[model samples]
Target: MFGSIWQYVYTNFLRYWLKWFIRQVTGKCELQRICSDYTPGASRTTRAENSLQASKNKVLRGALKTSRDHVEQCVDQIMKAKNIKPQKDPLFKGSLHICLLQITGYSSLYTSVEELRKEVFSSENPEHEAMLLKLWGLLMPEVKLECRITKQWGDIGFQGDDPKTDFRGMGLLGLINLVFFSENYTAEARQVLSHANHPKLGYSYAIVGINLTEMAYSLLKCGALKPHFYNTVQGTPELKHFHQLYCYLAYEFDQFWVAEQPESIMLFNQYREKFHDKVKTHLQDPDVSLTLTVGSY
Candidate 1:
């Protein structure tokens, strides 16, 4: 039903009416919003959830990434000092899960969508596969599993070669930068733009990588790291703003920001494009206007 609805909208209404609807909602003069309209969350089906559950079924449940021991200790301390038993499941499991995924790194996963499709769809592990799909969906809703730079690096390393030299000379940091600034970003591009909340998550997730880019830039500027972004986006003078925003997300402010506004976590990506601008903004300045779409506060 949902797919059919989307199909109908795509076939007819999307090009004509959707822009009007967006204009009504956002009150902006331009029809373009540089960001995907929808993004995944606990309420939405996502690719990340599917991948996460699959990892859990593979007996890697204990391995998800989380904050450092110091952070966990602080959390525990707060719980005890506040006399709050706290919700054990969401806290422990959620933190652990994020951590494990980070440690394993999305790059370390299957090198291609075909591998994931084959592994999960195969009959060898029906229940486990189902679980994996569920988890993956939560993390990356409708995210088309992909392979681009990161996967290229993975393939190189997997074939018993050194990543730095044997791989395409592009590492995670490189892939992260490519995903946003370059129009030629290959791997995750096609999938991210079309999916449900998946696109939104990709935008937000890219923030982490983009921020990493900023740090690499800052550090390099300070003679710390020998890396820099191409620093090119086609339009808008706001690229530097995005650099500042992302740098804050990766290092200085993620934890504090979350702590300060727990209620705003779900709408984490509501403000991304204002800083970085979108592909359309870079390539062609969109002139149509619409009302500003307010994200979750």
Candidate 2:
């Protein structure tokens, strides 16, 4: 009896005291407000429920000034005190809280994408060469290509002979997204590649895929995809989540192209712009999913 009482009291002490500690260190006014609103004598369940709701309201109102990392740490501390799982916790799983985390996650992801954009993919880097080969192998498992950087790159999807020149704009990020999609969903990736090679409506597969990466990045930056991210993701998003978004765009755009029935690849930009506008409109809704329903096409 005494142990249980002591444990409960100690848990509350930590939860209540940490708010003041956070306020003094971070100077986040919203945390101060949340801490001050705690009602003493409330049951532990009630306290947790109230705190989670208050945090969500603050997040939605744009009143929370605390950084995502700090908030995440706070949640960790609370969960440890309460002996609860993170994903099962009400605070982190709430839509508004996830929305805030998504914002922070997107900022970090965009910075990474920007850094990758600046780096020119080089064959000298063993990792880059390995990834390039892995990408080709994942897409064309049956046909083996030479290890040397040569025109054989065209056998997959590069514009010219050497695939290295093709990474000028999107750089390593584009290649990584392409590789991620192919490695995770080989069949769907091959189908998309086949569509890109259509006799009449054929487009440059790698080039179009990279362009879609730019589009995905742009949507994330402008907050157009917030609705989708906020609702679908129950916790902090990650780089793989961004890559997944790119995969969706790459796959869906191929379907869009084939459906549009354009006369030739010459009309790509026109159809591409149309598809972009459609995505923007979908994002305008507060409940957009934008999930890729890939199948064995």
Candidate 3:
């Protein structure tokens, strides 16, 4: 109770006075210090975001909500409000511009991801069907699928004969990630599929890939992926970047499952939670970059 009260008091009162004192002494705002102190990555971007969110000034706080195109204008407003001179701190404008881009870019990325997730898989869509078949061909190049709704789908780890039903929740987003990994990292995707085909330790490749899609989506939704994106992509992160992150999770999870060697597939949820926790732990680092290193298998 006391700790909570202390936090409330500190955030509401002491924090403002402390920042005021620091600004008076250093002639630099919190955002200025953040940009100067930390390099161009999550460390700087995250701190600048937090500082802007916590500021009493309207322009500073509004910068967080500014659109991607207007980020420069927002930065200018923030500089004007804080009395920051571009001539004096040459690097400050550029650094803060990048930070705002990353911050605002994250929101835009989530919007794109959410739109994809909402797109339900339709078998009637020739494009969707082609992508699904493409995934099978990429993973199982030699084998020919007998029919569209055959039991052969099991070879690639679909839960049922038709992979359409499995995408009810994650929708096209899941299929897109599956195809992205298989398309971009063909060798690694097949290697991971081989691991999934293991008798004892094997798990469903497509199903788990979709599950990891949900994981990636959850992390992105909750802003847990901000650091990873901020560290890796200097500017606005795009849909392909999100898919690449999914590729990393898919490959890494396969290795993790093979190493752990859980007794049976029924233990997947338990192990999935374990893997999720591990990824979350890694995201805690300021320099976390969860890219899948090709040829590492």
Candidate 4:
């Protein structure tokens, strides 16, 4: 309780001090007159309240501007303090721009992906368990199974009664991609899962799904997917967007594998690498964007 009280006091004092500082810097009349410009008919009390809010907003905008400048200054200072010389070569600047693009994009997209991936993969979470069940139900609607766990997991490609074991490496991210693909394109997901169970060239359904998740994660980590995100997403990318990327991979890989017609599952890595190379080649283009071509064979 004391801790809470102290926190409240500290927060209020800081807010008050910041507003006071802003008022002093901008001058009381200028800050107060901001709202009056557009609110000519407003009552005196209403104008006063508007002036207070406007002053706060002006302070916030000023602080944000300063904060951005401070960040850039700090970066320069750190580089200089470390005896680092700025790049002189044009080629080096181009390379640095590319690197910065990836670094910044990864910072925004990867953090959210990791958070969602962690939350969904934890076996102890009831919400994750429910989501798993829902994913199953969405895929295999005709076959009604009991709420309790059972061998019915095999219907969607798990090796055992409990499917969570399949998510060992990929975490919730794999399952989420699978679910997103299945839920959005139900027929497509089922068709792919059916092909996965083909007797001669069959692969583990959930296992391969998780592998594709890794592929998506790696592309994201190395900045290969930055162009796609930069072009496709207007602002910050989120977990759902990452899942969509996984969906594209899952769908595209199925097509590539079937078209290749490998002799056996033993050749999976070879074919997977080939597909990875193909994607990397595409990323080499400045105009490349990774949009899913649903139902386009």
On TM-score, the leading prediction is 3
lDDT of 1 by residue, 180-227 (tens): 322222222323322212322222333334344544344333321100
Candidate 3, residues 66-140, lDDT tens digits: the string is: 899999999888889988998989999999999999999999999999999999999999999999999999999
TM-score of 1: 0.18
For all predicted structures, in order, the TM-scores are: 0.18, 0.70, 0.97, 0.62
Better of 1 and 4 by TM-score: 4
By the lDDT metric, which is better: model 1 or model 4? 4
Put the candidates in TM-score order, highest first. 3, 2, 4, 1
CA deviation > 4 Å runs, candidate 1: 1-172, 176-203, 224-252, 262-297
Alpha-carbon deviation at 184 in model 3, angstroms: 0.6
lDDT (0-100) at residue 234 of candidate 4? 45
The local distance difference test score of each candidate is 0.31, 0.68, 0.94, 0.64
Off by over 4 Å in 2: 1-66, 72-99, 295-297
Q: Taking the tens digit of each residue's C-alpha lDDT, what string does model 4 give over 224-268?
A: 786666555543456677877887888888888888888999999
Clashes of 3: 0
Q: Report the poorest 10 consecutive residues by lDDT, candidate 2.
A: 38-47
In model 3, what are the clashing residue pairs, if there are any? none
What TM-score, to 2 decimals, does candidate 3 have?
0.97
Query: What is candidate 2's lDDT per residue for 1-297, written digit by digit as tens?
Result: 999988787566765577657756755333223333432211221233335544423332232344676655544444354344445434432423344455455556667777877788998999998998898888888887865666767766687777888888888988998998898878888998888777787888888888988898788777677666655565556667788888889888888888888987788788999999999988776557787777532
Greater-lDDT candidate between 1 and 3: 3
Candidate 3 differs from the real structure by a C-alpha RMSD in angstroms, to one decimal, of 1.5
